[model samples]
Target chain A: MKTTDNASASLAEQSNDEYSVRITGFWSGRSELIVPALVFILAGFLTYGTATMKVMGTSVPGPQFFPTIVCVLLFLMAIIHTIQILRTRRFPHEDSEGQNADFSTDLLSDLADTENEAIYVPTARPSVTGKRKAYSDWKTLGMVAGAVAAFILALPVLGWILSAAGLFWVVCRALGSKRPLFDLSVAILFSSAIQLAFNAGLGLNLPSGFLEGLI
Target chain B: MESLSLLMEGFSQALTPMNLLWVVIGAVLGTAVGVLPGLGSAMAVALLLPITFSLEPTAAFIMFAGVYFGGLFGDSTSGILLNTPGNSSAIASTFEGHRMALDGRAAKALATAAMGAFIGGLIATTVVVFFAPVLVKMATAFGPAEYFALAVFAFLAISSVVSDSVVKGLMSLGLGLVLALVGVDGPSGTARYTLGMPELFDGMSIVVITVGLLALGEVLHIASRIHRDETAVRVESKGRPRLDLSDIRRAMPAWLRGTAFGVPFGVIPAGGSEVPTFMAYGLEKKLAARNGDTDFGTTGSIRGVAAPEAAANATAGTAMGALLALGLPTSATAAIMLAAFQQYGMQPGPLLFERSGPMVWTLLASLFIGLVILLVLNMQFAVLWAKLLLIPRHYLYAGITVLSVLGVYAISSSIVDLWILLGVGLLGFMMRRYKFPLAPVLIAVILGPLAETELRRALTVSQGDLSILIDSPVTIVLYGLLAITLVITGIQHLRHSKTARSQALKFDTDKLGV
Candidate 1:
């Protein structure tokens, strides 16, 4: 809402003055473009450095080939873009300047305001009762991360079913399923279905987990 | 007669009970997933990919094609009825279809949209069937340089034309190329970007990248805005959509014109459908305005519904052609479908046409059948589909997140994939938030290795003579097409700017209270 108010105020100012210095059009005063451009340069440098290192018979095209190509393209595009922005900034009358005058101003202001709001928006405080809730939404992220970690840690020793079911249960809980019994049942059923379809139906040699001997 | 015989054989293969079952299942599942807001075709295909691992390649692709077409049709239903487009392609339909829905003519709008889609789809498929063989014959002669050039063309076309800014689009593509560079270098058999991590030696799975980025990323995005009061409500249909003589007469020209606008743009690498649909809509509006149809917006002009709907489906069909022939996916959905093709150890290129001609023909044959199925399904069960809007957003998205995690895990029993999924999901969320188009990223990732391998091989073959790129007629023609596409798009942008200027002038005049 603050962003909306800011955008509206900017629009009002733009409309009020006909000869004001207007920062307008695409790529107008946005810093996010710098991130990708810098990333390209860094990636290119790393790729070039790696490629220079030789290993055995195949030196891997000196790493600089592919990365350099990508980097150069990105750099050229960025340069062309920066030039266009500057050119537009300098020459305001060669084209339909008056027409874009309002539209671009509105767009820039809206974008700037929205970005400001995103940066400045304060986090909501949880109520006293909300703090003690059994299943926190953030716990879902933790559970998923835990499930994946558990799968990796236990897959060799505990096998597929144990790890898969653990994953399934964690994911289901993350999704707000509260019934432990139902969650376990669903997980077992899903694992069995997968085992049957992949191992039995298609003859894929999937890890049978602890159920390796039974069936 | 020879082509007719091949067609008959294709129908025989396509009409089998087993294939029919797959088609129906695919359509049903595709539509269901597509109707769910934020679950696009790419996610649907990626999630179902694990299931396809157990099926025959033919049956797997049969179902994939069914899902692809069905998703397109299904997305339009939500776009029209709920004013929530499931994919960016359906955004234009929301403009007029929602207006018609507000006017209590939802049924008519739905009917017109379905019919227009059917016509556009059928025409495009027919074009594909005839044009594919010739294109394949030409593509067979292409060496690595030509192939690399073609990939460049695709990258240039999609990045420049699809996104609002060419810079952001190219940046998204650079990100994809970087992601693709991870894991072992295929040509030289050395680690590239693995960064001392053994798990990354095999590289990140496309399944993980796609599911994490598209599905899980979408869920996180929705969750970030959970407090927002945006929810889809089911709109009750007043009655069955009727095609009155007058309405049909009015919509017919728009349908034809829409197809004209759509078919060409679809063949181009621009993944976005906004251009053609908007072009059709603007043209129709201008023509109607000239005829003194001042009530165009208020009365819900038939052209409004017809042009965008036809253009949307036409673009969908031609996009498939580009994918099947060039192995370049212009959109996320096409990129996922490309992954599906790769899953079967099949590369969709000139060889696919030569070796799997029957399957290709049959797939094209099924598209015709699928259109009829879509028409019948959309016209009769539209209200039923509109009910999908009532499903709680939290539950739907939560379920999808669960499925996405499961899907990536299912592909490889490795926990590392899950970690990759989470990482890619974060990346996807960032890209979306930053307005970087995701399609180019997918295309670049999928095609990067291929481009590298081919470029190396071509250089080896030609002994490093770069002029070999333009030596062939096919490559020449392709370059010509790319040049023409760039010029045309540039002109179109200029024209669009001019139109915007006129509109602005008109707005200023009105603001002066003249």
Candidate 2:
């Protein structure tokens, strides 16, 4: 037990060092402001552009007016915050020597080094040398995205039951469920119970799709 | 005497078999969800909201109260056993609790936490029973402008104080306000941000946003980390947990201290249990240190577990008072309960106290009863709850996601609603990832219309006299409290930054082998 504990502790220590290096490499002070700012800008522009359209009737204000104001505010705030972050140049906690690593210069130097050091490209899998994988687990992301897409596409035609079951199965499988039959049954039971509870028990009119008459 | 008589009448109503059954069911379900990591009372209530449409107002509220109290009990179980807090309030409990578990005193820790919860909950409920009438009298005197100011206070206090960064918190609030701006303009009937979608005329349902953001968003976040090799270590207990006379004596002081810390914070508009729990823990730690009980970190200090647990439960009761009396929810769970009240067309405010005095009194009475129920239940079932950790994460989160999607669709039968859920889910994910607080966004959306309508109505009534806002003593006090809270929070932030810098320097010195 002691030996195993020691081995696990060493492994964890090594992984912690790797994680810290990676996090410090990517998560610069400016990146925090830059990423959120870009997202807000994109979302703000979309909201503003959509709000600009005309809608009939009630003359209180156009549909776009409030959203436009919000978008403009968001854009202005993001820009101001980003500029403030840039002016600070470095986080408060960094060592003076570390602060001298200009962010843009570091990025450019790293890219150039990578280009020079290019060799036999590694496959996107666990290495035979037993090194840990460097890339994200894309399969899990795909599974979640697929489940969402299936629900959106199937909800209209296949209705709640089929679409819900499909989404649940996809997600469960992604999470490492191997018992397809048992998991599927569990999903169906849950979905049916919810549907009945809302429709019959609560007097809600949930969609029945093609099975509307049969139910 | 009149209030007592009214409460007796309320007990007569609440004691009915149907209401009793609903409360029990709600409590059981609430505890179950609360015990599950990442599943909270807010998500539970939000999921059950569609089903509440058919129930009577009194019964629905009874069930909601049961769920709220049950969550308080349930969250502590996770904190004590796994060190993964089911709620933010339980985070402080984990510091001492996980230490106790490591010391092979898990059962003792669990027992003390349960006892402390009962004591705190009982005291808080009694305070509510006695003090709610006075609060109602004060709350009733406020006009539209005062209410509007109160709403602004709630928004700013929650956004700035609850989150790690004020900017991100304000950004989340701005996002929520933008979402609330959708649908028709109430004053002029003009479409705002609906984008020609007739289905959005009623605006996005709070239910959809809540379920998508909290339940579905959590499912996604959990999935992202599922394949990670790291898992929590489980401790095996040698025997059943029992409380000795010494344990009881040690815990009693901490319970009282925690209650003192919790009740006032709960009454405030911030509506979070974290502050009270931390304050209680800090106080206990200081007292223990002064008494030369620095060994509390090694040997399980009953005070360490008791204080945070008591604060967690005590805050639950005070939060209810804030909700029922002020119609303002300080937490996500409270927000969902507010939605449930609205669903039954029963607004919770000063009028509620006047019109439903008996009901409110009985509800307060049931809290005392609920505390007893939770204590009995937790003591008997601590082991059973610990076993829940063995359940596969995949099955649990997947099931929650499926239920959320179905619940949203069932509410309105609109595909547009599903789209809104997806959109909100993405927004919630981003907010969580970026450390932006989600509670303020929900509060802003829930109260946005009320603020706007009240502001407009007050202006018309005052004939554009802005001084009408501060015309009443009540409004003046409310604004005064808001100003003090802002100043205090700013000072606290400055202190925190200074402490963090010193701590960082200490770490650097240690790293240099000095």
TM-scores for the candidates: 0.79, 0.85
lDDT (Cα atoms) of all candidates against the true structure: 0.67, 0.70
Retained native contacts per candidate, as fractions?
A: 0.07, 0.22
lDDT tens readout by residue for model 2, B1-514: 6656766677777788888787788788778887887788888888888767677777777887788888878877777777666676676676678778878888888888888888888888777776777778878887898888888888777777555556666666677777777777677576666667899888889899889878887776566556743455667644666898988887888899999988887777664777677778777777887899964767667788899889878888887887888887766677788887777677889998878777787787666666777787777777777777788888888888887887787687777888888778866655554445788778878887787677667766777677887887777887898888778766766665576557645543333234
Clashing pairs in 1: A51-A62, A51-A63, A160-A209
Best by TM-score: 2
Query: lDDT per residue, candidate 1, B62-85, as tens digits?
Result: 787778877767776777677666
Query: Which sections of candidate 1 miss by over 4 Å?
Result: A1-45, A52-64, A71-215, B196-198, B232-234, B470-514
Question: What TM-score does structure 1 among the candidates reach?
Answer: 0.79
Calculate model 1's interface RMSD in Å.
10.5
Q: How accurate is candidate 2 locally (lDDT)?
A: 0.70
